[model samples]
Target: MSKLLNWFKQLDENLVKILLIGFIFFVPLWPKLPLKMVDYTYIAVRFDDIYLAILAFIFLIQLLRKKVLLNKKFILPFFVFLVAIFASFLWNAYITKLIRLPHLGLLHSLRRVEYMIMFFIASSVIKTKKDFFQVISYFFISVLIVILYSLGQKFLNFPAVQTMNPEYAKGYILYLTPDARISATFGGHYDLAIYLVLAIPMILSFYFAKVRSFYLYLFIGALLILLYTSSRSSFIAYFVATVAFLLFTRKFKFLIFVLILTAGLMFTTGEITKRFLKTFQVRRILIDDRTGAVYIGQTITTKELPAGSFYVKLKDQSKGDNLDTFRNQVVLERTREATISGEISTLVEEKKYMASLSANLRPVNTVVSDISLATRLQVEWPRAIDAFKKNPLLGTGPSSLTEATDGDYFRWLGELGLLGTIAFLNILFLILKTIWVGVNKLSFSEKLIGYGFIFGFFALFINASYIDAFEASKVAYTFWTLAGLYIGYYGLKYEKA
Candidate 1:
């Protein structure tokens, strides 16, 4: 161990950067710290967070010694963004009752510092062609292992590394089951899926740059795993990114081939094809007649009125709760009881009629309805808008609300207000602006990478309007690191004098 320490001490700054990048790329599966707490099983300081903090510290030492350079172009916007976040956090904590708890808002605001550390390290350290290729290649390899693990979970009943509080995480349980959406090594299915969205384009960039058969194999495996995850938003984001890549790089034939291949996969690939086809199904209307039913894991306040159920009547003292609440409660109670009695009789004759249709069409134990979109519209999005309206300048504050923002735009806007929102957008704009500086200076391979990052970031940005992709730890880490690599690849021209 002393000898190892001596060797480590002897190594120079370049080696430290290389090793940290490798760790960032290769170690998604290493954060399996076996600890659990009430309402939360995940550790407060996860392994990835530790690795990133170390990377940032090493970069700091290099800067102090004048051994490395920082990207000066981004410094203004980056720090401004952090200031906005902290300002909003402070306001919500002290003045407004938006976040209620000051500590929670402060905690959320501080997470930005951790995320930006990666951006700085990546943009500054990985500044050469050799470094860019090596780091991204390692990342591809790491995700390939992720794909294999997902397949194992799907085929072999592999147990998941539990990170969520089991009592509160039905989604985590669903992901672990056979025929379920696989999260692979990541903490959540959305995290895994969006990480693939950011990565699949870049891996394909390698293939287009050199026609490497190894990259081709990796791409195929990654695509298969992405499909198996069955995340509709991920699928959409990846498709758009892939299209942008093909158009920007002028790989029209290859693009056609991939499209055909994906179409073929949709039919030939068992669960994926079914999921893809399910996207087009009419979900608003159900054949059965029930006021409430279980869909996915939530109780659905379904709308196809049972014959005599719709009545514009005053609240009765004898009847408990409001109509909507009462309906949902009944649905939740029945769903819980349905876990025991599978063949419970319905209160309505139309429900019995629809029961046959549901048995044939819907998955077992789930009613034939989709409330995800409705929930976003009625609950999450409206709540964010309400918060934004109340405090348009700085909104509420950091994590003022629960994880219900569903949309990142609203999360940032509603939580941090205009000041935070503008800062956040500026950070992304400057990064992309730096990458955009070189139109003709980049080589074909470099152009492919630049295009891949641009398109990938675009997809994720759009995806954020649906889910809080920007705030998610793994996705945020990957985004900033990729942004750093792209900046290193083509953004060096915009470097400080």
Candidate 2:
């Protein structure tokens, strides 16, 4: 027992720092392979979970031994946020019974803590700027590997293990189709795209600060990967964040160069551009009043872009007929049923329909939205609103709305209500405040990096408006890890000054 205690006492902070460096590479590079499947959700307990658990255990021991000191910079907000999460869980699970499964709700609540705790662990290990830069160097190396693997997936037919669906979550290796977006080591393309949105700004900042060609090359590679991911929200977030970073850093001369490169890449990879154009279109739709049948006049070839249905009564059917229309579209029709001696009879009839419909039918021009945006607007967004309305304070609790809300704000509002949302936002507010104050104290290169991280966070906020970015494991974990390092480094500099 004494020997064991002595050995633990000898365990130093360097070991923890080394493990942190390893994690810098592991979280992004390692594929998400499920170790155990959980009920109610497809989100499985993976290798990363086990690794994080072990890391946390070791970190706890070091804290107990006084080898590492905790940073209490963002402690108050985190505590309040956690209280809100547990309060919501307890309210829904025991009081309201909105949470059908107590265990699932508890796990969902715990997962948030698991992701956030890394901030403290990362901060505890960074005692100096050297430690900060060393970890960042490993991070860039990991990014390079991720970019290379994405390229391999695009051209070399690399296999991927994705959790986009329940079946895929079972850990089957999938070879993506030629036109499929590259997810790299992430769960999906959106995850990959958001991750790049966070990293690209920092890469560019480093290049601009040091004028290093390697950093420039890395930026171009990451941008290419971002384009390949083909995530519209992340793409928009990337541009907004990059522009903000450059403007804040006063790198105005490089704006034209950045624009030319992005435009050229967008032109070369026209898939995303085409998707944007196809988001909304005016189309002719025929509706039958008698049978309540809807017929879309246009045919969609690619499954990637599906149109949303919207109907508006045409003031004049003649106006719809005047527009270019489908002359004769073949459709299945049902014949009237007749009863003879208590036996029902029916017939299937094939008919040709046109924009000029019968008196029982109405033809109108309706606007159709793409499936991606349509899902959020029609189903996911409304569902969240309904959940929020049910309990304006505590919400319907976590996991009540199934796997995704598509938007983080809606998810927070629907699951945790205003209290949870406000607390989490406070945490962000505190972090941003710390960054704003400490960034000026940093050296030239460090200051540029700080600016990059600040804008990267801004980009994520834009992404969260459309995507549940903070909910995703890879992106969320990376964000918190980098954020911790940034805060830790800032604290070190502030104390020194």
Candidate 3:
């Protein structure tokens, strides 16, 4: 352990700077970064996971130069996870007779491997306090660029700037309000929202780090951007981070200040407050039959009357609980309409209709619910589970889930089988447990920082129930880096004193 620590302490600062520079490439790829360049590519049969591949090469060169030493001290389990996942992919390809998976598809097969390399860089390279602060500082500086550019896109109507694409410009710049929500340079609103959610915590950490007053202002500015995006997952992420931070610190005074400051901000920014309040309205619309049904059915502007019935089904006798009652009413009303119009009839008909209704309703519900309850668990999870059941040992290939199954868990089973899934699950449980234990050992301020990342991970995990954030390049990179930080901070048993 001392040898490992000493080796880590000798890591060259210049090499560390190169790794930080590599981080810059990723931000432009974020949807609506006001740039138009496809950040990754494939040549012939070879695929490049731009960020990961680049980082891996840099790390390798650094090791070769002896600027940093590569020792597999804390990386065994991560390696196992990578090997198991890749082996499963090869097994899936052999069984499924895919002829050839897309070159890019096969490229992502290295994602976990790339992530493990990042963990090594983070764990070994970030030894001294200066090295640690530099990493954190680089992160905030990059965030500043993101915030500034996103603001430029939102306010100045910055023409789309991309290295590869020019026609991708969005004219208006409001990021949080749903109608004309800006993607800046990203793929869409959701993409920008996801990046912002993950970055927000790190930005907040810098804000409280006592670096400068401008950081506090930047934090406020970022919060405004979040409000404008009106992304429920991001909002929930903020809430989760806040609650976890507070609970961990047990700082009542800070908690009260936060609540009061929040209320004050809501009072001051009528537009933002209106929109924040509007999310609850969205929740209301989701559950209400008359408004929600039209919204879900895409009949909000349809001149043609819907062929089916529209009404309510109160599942329970409960009152004063608006959302559940509204959902029940919608089900009942829709069922009655279906029966009256002969679209469907009887309890079986109602069940079928609701199930059909969910195909459309579920996406919105999932988006609001972080895609866990309505979509991931309800639809995709079952499908994935079935796929896993069929191939219990060496399941399916990477990206096979989108093609063959729907649930991530099932994707694990289909690609890796029950064996791979169990292995993956064990790794996940270990990481979460490690982070949780680390959180318990931190100073109050450090605990807040740790808690923020933990909340971000949980938020993404919940969001993954519907969408594939884990598979997404930007989210995936951020997750693994933070995971690495967590391991380094806690797993090393490095005493601050």
Candidate 4:
């Protein structure tokens, strides 16, 4: 077919520009179909890596023939950053070995360079606004598929391929009860949510630019998915990116629309919030008798309470009252109000535990009582800080930390140290600078490309504060490739001019 011939043309490495566009569509959403090794280490080669490798090999041969050139601005900083990545990696490896500390191996450390290479290839390949536009089409087409699958996954229990966790085993699909947050084709809900945080803002820009109504619908779908994720940090990131995009593009009316939509969603959101809020509230107060599970609705003196239970005096309440007593009273009052409001059936299982800290489980800092937040602050951050202090120039190597590096910036500081940190920042500075330059020169419809690059990147950056989103495979690959397209488009345009 003629379409097949055209596809061949697009895949041809001699036409590097077109081939890179093809890579954009195929790579990011490729299922994590990993190669199982006999040694028990899984080799997960992403499509981005495969296609880019092919592109590199083809371009290398062309380089010998003097048919193509890899050129771009920010070359100096980019290589320096690469060097920093390796140097910090090697330094940490040496230090960790000398100090007998943990470190991420060579493969994990060097793998980032592979992600960055697409930026260079993209910069080399794209020669016009048309090229960038075509590439954007490739990207969103893949996204639309992901969106459709994610929404579909909500109703129909589709089989998924995930190696990330035991919950997401080879034969399993990740599920949650009542309202299961959909992970779709991605590895997890957090991954899907962060990807949307970067993507939704970029897609929404098309609506304001009068590009098409289709993208607007896509944006709405993405927003629905984002809410379904229930990731608070991602919500904050998307909010920041949305505001930043509107302000930069000077589109205030849509901002108002977003605010109204958020208010609407808040009213309509069901059991998810109730269940989430309940985690912070006290539930049942046991009288130390497993058999005495009945609710008497009796007001007894503090002296009559169970021996093992906690008691604390409050400023407003009677002196002998405790947190459990306070919780029980609140629940009873609320229950009576709810009965008056509408009705909730009884005869459920007897409430067993209350979350409020009593005198027995008194924390050093009462205010920092959130268990999740407390763990991050008390355990992860301190461990990272100590790692950084040990080798301040370049901290412990990648994977050196004992647990997940939930905070990306700190991970860089702890793993790579100052040299790596500066390099990484410089890399971002250059990418942003390229996008900044490209935006001014674009036509109205085409300008969304630049807007997408700018705002989506900020969203990812914001997400990086709480998660290592930049290192996330899908986010990293697509981001670099888009930035590369922008840079390449800019270079081609300037050269002709």
Candidate 5:
């Protein structure tokens, strides 16, 4: 027993650092497969959760034994944020009873902490510059694995396990259809796309700094995967972030090369371009005033309109006469199949419904949006705004907005309210501020990599406008981990300088 205790005591911070290195590969490359199901939510307790929980427990024990020291720089803000989360959860779950399931609400609140704990774990474990670079090399390898897996999914009929729906969350393996977006090891295409957006800039920075062919190949592969994901928001984020990083680093010639390469890849797929163009279009729709039934017409893709375009509702001039004129204006004959059941027999008839609906049909020209944006505008965003209106200070609570608001700002406002949002934003602000200050003291190559992190962060912020990228488990974990590593390295570099 004494020998075992001595051996345990000998286990040092290096063990934790090694695990953190493994984390860089584990979090992104591992598929989200459900190990246990959490009640009242589709979010299952996956292997990564179990892994992190164990890691956190070990870290805590180490801290207790004086084997490691905690970074206190973020404690205050993080504490306040935790307080806000619990306060909101308590208020909503018990007092007001806005949150129906108390356990789920608490779990939702704790999940935020779970997502962020890696930041401190990462920051505390970096003892030297070697540690930083070694972990980063592992990260590059992980990206390569992710890219290869994505290619496998695209060409080699690789199976995917996704959590986009409750059915998919049950750990079922799915084969993607030919036209389906590739998620690789991620829960969804959006998560994978955002991950690529965050990673590509950093890869480019390293390639430029070291002039390495391997990083260059990784960059190209990552871009191809990004195209395959076909997430418009991520595409936009990638373009903006890549451009900002290149221009800020004054890589003008390389900027042109990146632009040309990206353009060629984008055009080669044309999936993203087609989706962007299809976001809004002018269409003719016929409304039956009597039955309140709407019949949508063919899309006028040639006359593509900007989002929120005005509709032309033609005034019924001599209502009956106009209806007759519209019916006559229909060039093609349309038929509807109706099953008529008599006392003894059932008869199927094809009716000329277009001519018969002359009295009630009203034609109008309106702008129609694609399913994705329409759902957000019509349902998700409005629901979040309603929650915010209910409680401006604390909103409803975590899990109050259901699975997602599809927008991080709205999710924060709806779930955490103003106080929680501000506190969380403060944590981000401090991290960025620290990076900004400490990065300047580093060598030129290190400085570029640091700036790459900043731009990647900016890209995520842009992505957050339309996607809950930060809320995504894989993306969130990877992000906080990277933030911690960068800050830890920056602190060491600053001290050395």
Candidate 6:
């Protein structure tokens, strides 16, 4: 027994750290029993139970050994960021009237604590290159399983395990498509796709870890699953990530390979290319028929507009009158303007006029819809900002984004105020700045892996413009884990380097 204990003691700390990384990633899978919390949106598996059980096991074993706690130089930025979060939480508890207080969104404050624990484990536990590679290997393996499951759902029509289970949805990635999305085995296709995008870089990180050529097959397989998903957003994100990765790593050979692939796609996808080119010809080409359909679609023929609607109504005095009078008025007005401008020759043609109007209006409708969704953030953000302007020291409160502003920035401002925003931004800049510093120190293989992590991060930031990615659980987890790995690598090795 002493010999066995000695054997365990002689094992490197880096290996244990790597195991801890695996434990954290795979912990989500262990919480099979779902408990629906009052404040949370869905049934959450009790991760706290699993975490406590693991911690107990670790603590019992550590009774026989000494533990080393590595002090990270970058800890200040992380602490500052956390302080800002608490400050914001407190501020919101005070200012917001309609919202509940005392327990004032304390659930989320606890969730932030959960995140901090994960970050602490990652930053402190991981201490060597061996640990980094081991963590990366597990990431690749975990994602490979996810990829296979998603592909099976997409192609083999694999049945969901929980049949007639209302709480559970179908497939690995459920709700894959309007017809059928490629979910593999995830709860939703979008989630699966997003997860895959995040994993690709981590897998590539193993390139310098002395992995076998078969790992390349795994990478290609993951890419295939992503393609099967046919998620346009994911596709765009992947392409952008690849380009950024190549550029940042200065992988000229890979860049040339991409150029060749682009050329091949242009050559092979003739029909698709034709359709792509046709979009640019929208102005030049107009089918002679469908003028009536085009006109009706273009003209705003009003029925009873919804109350408090943003829609503008003019000449709505007579209920008896159809939209025909307005249509005629529009036509007459256009004809008169054309006559005055000496475009009467062109006005003689009905086809040209209708086409122009329809083309113009189609874009307007699209723009209007886009703006309406975007305006939710725009409107809520200013209010949050105004709140910050009122009290710039302490923030509004925790989860103030949902209460005070629909936006990430404004929510930070409203909850934490200006002081908090600066602190939060400092944390963000610190992470990026550290990554920049690390990238310079890496070899070709390390740089390749780092490129994926960096590019994935860059993609997330771009996506943040459209969606509050940092606010979502899945996206936030992915972002922080990568950030943790990057920081952990540098923190543990800062002295050695």
Instruction: Show model 2 residue runs off by greater than 4 Å.
Output: 1-11, 288-294, 298-304, 310-345, 348-361
Instruction: Return the top candidate by TM-score.
Output: 2
lDDT of 4 at 199: 83
Which should have the higher lDDT, number 3 or number 6? 3
**TM-score per model over all chains:** 0.78, 0.90, 0.66, 0.76, 0.87, 0.66
How many pairs of residues collide in model 5? Answer: 0
Give lDDT tens digits, candidate 6, residues 1-497. 99988777665444446446655455423212344433433324354445544753463354235453533565687677677666556556655532355354566665555554455455555557876666756766667666666666656676432211335522122333223545543334444556666666555555434466756567667666665554445555666776677676576785676557644644453332332332221111112132422222132322111111112223333343244444555556665677678676663465577456434432111111122233543466666776677677765566544532334665666666677678867877787777667766766666566666777776665544434445544445556666777778764444455
For 1-497, candidate 4 gives per-residue lDDT tens digits of 99999887655644665566567666546655543321222335555567778877776676566555676366788788777767766765675572233223565666677788777777765655676667777778878888887767776665455545543434354454435566776766778888888888778876766658898888878877777766667878888888888877777888888878865664565423443452232223322232322222234442122121222223332223244554455455645565566554453311212222122222111111223444556677788888889888877766676436677888888877888888889889877876666566667655765676688888888888877787777677777877777677665654554
lDDT against the true structure, per candidate, is 0.68, 0.83, 0.55, 0.65, 0.84, 0.53
* Residue-level error in angstroms, candidate 3, position 427: 3.9
- Of candidate 5, the 10-residue stretch with the lowest lDDT total is 335-344
Among all windows of 10 consecutive residues in model 2, the one with the lowest summed lDDT is 347-356
lDDT of 4: 0.65
Instruction: State each model's C-alpha RMSD to the native.
Output: 8.8, 4.2, 9.8, 10.3, 5.4, 11.4
Model 4, residue 206: distance off in Å is 2.3
Q: What digit string (tens of lDDT, one per residue) describes model 3 on residues 1-497?
A: 99987776654546555664456445434443332222233111112255456767777787787776553544566667777776766666665653146443465566556645665676556555565565666666666666677777777775433212234332233334323555555545445566666666555555554556776676676666666554555566666666565565465675676667656655654344544443322221343332453333323321221222222333433332234444555567767877899888577867878766644432122212222233545556776676666667766556555532323455666566766667777766777787678667767566666666666666666555444555544556666666666566655533452
Model 4: colliding residue pairs: 104-398
Q: Alpha carbon lDDT of residue 97, candidate 3? A: 50
Indicate whether candidate 2 or candidate 5 has the larger TM-score.
2
Output the lDDT of residue 136, model 1.
73
Error of 2 at 290 (Å): 7.1
